[model samples]
Target: MSRPSENGLSSETLFFTATWNGDSTRCVARLAPAVEAVPVFPAYDLRAQFEIMRLAREKAGIPAPRTLWFEPDPAPLGTPFFVMERADGQVPPDVMPYTFGGWLHDASPAEQRRLQDASVGILAALHQTAFTAEELAPLGEAGLRAHVAAQRAYYAWAHGRRPIPLLERAFAWLEEHWPDEPGPDVLSWGDARIGNMMFRDFTPVAVLDWEMAAVGPRELDLSWMIFLHRFFQDITTGAGLPGLPGFMRREDVCATYRELTGYEPRDLDFYELYAALRHGIIMARVWQRRIHFGEQPMPDDPDDLVLHRATIEELLAGYEPAS
Candidate 1:
């Protein structure tokens, strides 16, 4: 907490890694409650976020950052924050998008697959991990129901001030085709894309981001794994560049996960749409945040905020978009 660089004034600091001076032991700090400067509905709660990560580390045997300390009061920092020992390794870069070019691109196909398999393997481990009522108490008891409910809430919140019709249609589609019985409810690594993982030597050393972590069917995470990579791949493929083709194909990831956990991934068609819906809602908020910070102007199309607009529509129409 004594890091001078991080002590400077700021309305909100969502996440940053701090290195101790003595031994240079690095730890990540996650601050909560969107600053008034960049408002988003359903402000993140420090306690709930803390519990998720703590439970994942202690109970799930997942490679999560070590939950070091949590400060609820805003006195020490402008907002409530929690610190965890920073997991080592490089995250596939966001700007270049690993699919396009970066360290991942420089690596051989086999090494990239090693990282991809390890990433899915971590997801398998999470799905296979069980939890008692007490361990899951902090996240609420909605179980699988909680997944849809949260997205519905997010859609409503994002549209309250800024309506995106594409998001509306996607939400409606999800509601109509909602699975009656979505198999077994397990711990879903809610934000389950490879982007959330840290890899060293083409292997996931740490799994980051648990704010979206929830208890849901395996499909939620599995579908997200496919959809997110496909999004990036679509971009690169559109540019006529060879993207991360072998990274996270639907069959390959599902097969690897199945091999590890002995559970066949199902209902991915529905879940991928769900993933787009979820990502679309978050993207809308992100654009709203950009507008709030005066960093970017509002676009002509509300769907502009949603990155995979064309893909979402195609999926809704019962067709896989060309990726």
Candidate 2:
């Protein structure tokens, strides 16, 4: 047993590298949030994520890491665990962010462009996956509306009494401008950012993290990837660093996806705001959890709990996709 360098691991998981019978293994031993278990996932059955990865790998031919076994019995490790083959590659770090400076930062713009296009290609292929009704059932109530409602439920659970007005306002904004045609629902990789994927030679070799997988409009995943990259890039440059400005532009991303899938991405203003709102809710929860652990203080303004308060305001102001 070994622990990988602690630099870039997911905060929500405890991981260990092990030998999987014969294949080298990376075991996802537990989901340990600071305050509570993720409300979206069920306690009894972890079948949803395992099956999602299988469908992506076997049917869609995506590079999702192959999960080996699941031991739902908590007696083994004090928490239920699963083992899967460890993927080898570099992942963009969420802490400092790859946009600040690193291997990906050192890569030429051409290589970065190659990585960008290839990453979106995974989403294009992922949407093509034929999911069973059983699969969709596990992903919460059907429809995009349900997805938003799930977020609302999660916020109520996460915040307890200290409601984030910014998040609530964003939710109201969503209600006011709901898409007339949200388009057909597809398999949306809920956390569809390059940061969740492992890349080799500027291409994705292993798509990691399916915790947020869902059945929704194609734009759900598309906007998530675009908004997250922009989120990091905005933060990096705000601190006087030269973030990857040319990468992951909304127009460029939509064009690439349209070229591959033959459907123009629509209602992205709604989805991207939805994406930021979703992230704001999560970030606010993370802050409140830190207070729970005495790692941080309760802020004077509750909206301050959300790291991207200004971004949420700007998004609320309204966005017109770059021409």
Poorly placed runs, candidate 2 (over 4 Å)? 4-45, 319-323
Error of 2 at 97 (Å): 0.8
Among all candidates shown, the one with the greatest TM-score: 2
Q: Candidate 1, which segments miss by more than 4 Å at Cα?
A: 1-24, 319-323
**lDDT scores for all predictions?**
0.77, 0.81
lDDT of 1 at 17: 47
Any idea how many clashes model 1 has?
A: 0
- Report the lDDT tens digits of candidate 1 across residue range 97-202: 7778878888988888898889888888887888887777666655556778877877777667768888888777766777777869877777887778888888
TM-score, candidate number 2: 0.91
lDDT of 2 by residue, 1-323 (tens): 55555343233455677754686556654342222533332232356777788788988899988887776666766655566677788888887888999989899989999999999999999887677887667777667898898888878877759888889888888898889978888888789999888899999999987878888899999999999998999899889998999999999999999988888999888999999998887778667657876888999999999898988888877563456
Question: For model 1, what is the error of residue 172's alpha carbon versus the real structure, in angstroms, after optimal superposition?
Answer: 1.7
